[model samples]
Target: METSDKVIHAIYNDDDVLMAAVKTVKAKRFHIEEIYTPFPVHGLDKAMGLAPTRIAIAAFMYGCVGLTVATIMMNFIMIEDWPQNIGGKPSFSYLENMPAFVPIMFELTVFFAAHLMVITFYLRSRMWPFKKAENPDPRTTDDHFLMEIPVNHGNERELHDLLSKTGAVEINVVNNTH
Candidate 1:
């Protein structure tokens, strides 16, 4: 992504005020670069007008793949490869003994859905083990919230004044060449 040459960082102390500021900024047609919060703010995405995520669809597909793998693995191990007779129950047909594989199938389905969903989230967020933090303000990691607005073409002064009116605790105009 191309980095912005200038940006404005507006700091808010409360999530409720931050959400209202987001709606106000959007109504004024200003492009919000990003927002950083110490904790997850409910309805922040809706305030920002972001589309709903598709992680649930991906999780369902992962669960289906896990079910298929478990079915094939159990059929090969218990019926085709090495048939065994335990407690007067013979592994002669997989269909006849499907009840014994239900638990394994369910467990594998849940396991794959959970693990793969986490991995998908990490990959989508560009987050991996040992990645350096990208937050601009240290206070945002604690009890503060930050809203970054890019200074598109020469709107620094206007954005600064507008954000200041929105009850920001602090406002900084940064030249983010790095």
Candidate 2:
């Protein structure tokens, strides 16, 4: 998103105001860039027309990768690199009866899936250590609801009127550039 574009936002005092604002915005066919609230609101994502996240897909892929790596590494280490007989057990074989390797494999799979999923989340969201968060209204973190509209074809006066009619207590035109 370019800094020069205009972003119109309305801050609602309560959830009733927020819910009404969302329905009105959707009814008007105006595109909402995003919304912020002190807490999750029911059906808010659906109102914004946002699709379900792909994090599950990412986690699954990472899990598969982890499992493959664990299996290959364990097989190589136990069967090929340093085969040894322990407790009169057979060497160079994945023991089906004992199942000693299953625990390690499971642990590695979980480790990789969790770590890689976190990394993927960080990268996808552009969230990094020491990076500034782009939260315009701090009140949204504490008892306020915010609705952001992409400034494309809508008139500022009309949008403001709509917000005010829907019980928005405060309306601000956020000039992203300056």
Candidate 3:
């Protein structure tokens, strides 16, 4: 979102109130820049009109890659590269010994899916190393919820009234530093 110079910060004490405020603001056709909450609020993403994320698809693909890698590595190590003579099973054939590789394949799939999903989410969020925090108020990190909206030239009063009607505990208009 490309925020303007001036913005409105509406702080709410309750998550339910915050949710109502969000719906109210969107009903009034105001664009919400962001919302900061101490914890995740269920259904907040849907309420914000945010597009459903496709990260699960990425995770499944990554899991497939991991499974492939595990299969190839196990095949090369046990069958082709160095065939071991353990338990009278020196066939040097992957198909014959496929049962023994099940645990490895499962672990690799879970590992790749979980780790890569986290990295992908971090990168997709543009949250690289040493990035400045976007939280506008410290109270939001504690027990409050903060909603930020880009302020148009003549919408301050209207926005303020709207927030107050929606149970916002405090509101402020501030100019952005950057």
Per-residue error for 92 in candidate 3, Å, reads 2.5
Q: lDDT tens digits, residues 3-28, model 2?
A: 33788889987886688789898999
Taken over the whole model, the C-alpha lDDT of each candidate is: 0.92, 0.81, 0.91
In Å, residue 169's CA in model 2 sits off its true spot by 2.3
Candidate 3 residue 89 Cα shift, in angstroms, is 3.0
* Best of the candidates, TM-score: 3
Which 10-residue window in model 2 sums to the lowest lDDT?
Answer: 89-98
**In model 3, what lDDT does residue 17 have?**
94
Better of 2 and 3 by TM-score: 3
Global local distance difference test of model 1: 0.92
Residue runs of model 3 more than 4 Å from their true location after superposition = 1-3
- The candidate with the higher lDDT, 1 or 2, is 1
TM-score of each: 0.93, 0.84, 0.94
User: What lDDT score goes with residue 147 in model 2?
Assistant: 88
Lowest summed-lDDT stretch of 10 residues in model 1?
1-10
